[model samples]
Target: MGAAMAAEAEYGRGERATPENWMYRPANGWTYDQVKELVLPFDWDLVDGNIVVRGMAVWWHNRVRNRLYYQLESARRRPYAVDSEQCIVIDDHNAPKPDVVVFDETGLDIRTVVQIPADKAVLAVEVVSTGSRLEDRFSKPALYAGAGIDYYWRVERDEDDLPVVHEFWLHHEAGRYVPSPEQPTHTGKMTTNVPFPVDIDLHSLIDG
Candidate 1:
């Protein structure tokens, strides 16, 4: 792989339009610092020593994300902040940015900090985009759980084109995510005790 890539870089015979980050290969997975050096766009993640470029979300996908973020951010108070498409560093080998991150202000520096460590995150939410099925369904859950994030929520579009949130928590003993019993497979409204006690009414928010 290394030799092939080196040859490719040397010849420059392929499309010159490829982004610089695509050509990056380190012995270890890309670290937060290394990525910062690349100066790539925000729509990327580091997974198992590979860089995954995230596609742009469709209209409906953005709608779901916006509504969810408003609900979480409005209800929360001091020392906590909500953001979209922010990086969460799990370790050297993995850094997957969930769509919405519920993070606390504890030890956070507003300046010179591009990513948050996993421990700073209270909850991680991923709204399943068409291009992100595998990452949202399998890879992200496992990565977040392994990093010991207390809460993880996955939002999917139902048959009726409404948002359905599935909540999970790290099973500390099992070292994986176990679906929250209190939060069933439902839509329109979400009332749960996650990160903190809160109730959200997503009903009609998707409509005009």
Candidate 2:
């Protein structure tokens, strides 16, 4: 048992540490210090749950990450920060770490996870890594939409295929995130026009 779990030992019965049973039980909230300590020793993810780590998922994530770093070097208007695998507190109720998050240049800084406000994100990207593809596809989209995020990208890689980045824009008319009418062409490039026009070569990221 980790120090964080020991400190929050009051959480009875439902106090499972596995993703299958561990849930965001806000009745006994966890502080960032607690979350950090617990994550240190285990190959686990501390979001709303403690997901046991998967090697393949970690592999795919790194593939995309290498390409993103290359692309960031050439970006026209750089984001305040481009953070991968860092938690952003949307509010008291929610905090999720997307695979790639771009913030406003003005508010970017190296601070605690709680300081990275979800609402300040201009773009949130999630790569299908392990459990709950539905969480990345459906659940997170709704959460980001509600948080008023301008852009959300779902990067999915299937067993025998290349990765695909599905674009969703927050449609002002319906106030929901719907797939863009036209799929981006495969110069392997795509761009976001809402927060800023960030040109990206999608093919390069997926190819790796």
> What's the number of clashes in each of the models?
0, 1
Stretches of candidate 1 off by over 4 Å are: 1-3, 7-18, 40-42
User: Cα RMSD to native, each candidate?
Assistant: 4.2, 5.5
Question: How accurate locally is residue 30 in candidate 1, as Cα lDDT from 0 to 100?
Answer: 52
Task: Point out the worst 10-residue segment of candidate 1 by lDDT.
Answer: 9-18
Question: Candidate 2 at residue 3, lDDT?
Answer: 47
lDDT of 1 at 81: 88
Which candidate ranks first by lDDT, i.e. highest?
1
lDDT of 2 by residue, 96-149 (tens): 667777777565545534456766786787777667487787877777887788
User: Which candidate tops TM-score?
Assistant: 1
Tens-place lDDT digits, model 1, residues 40-114: 554778888577888888988888888778888888877788998888889866878788999887788889778
TM-score to native of every candidate shown: 0.86, 0.69
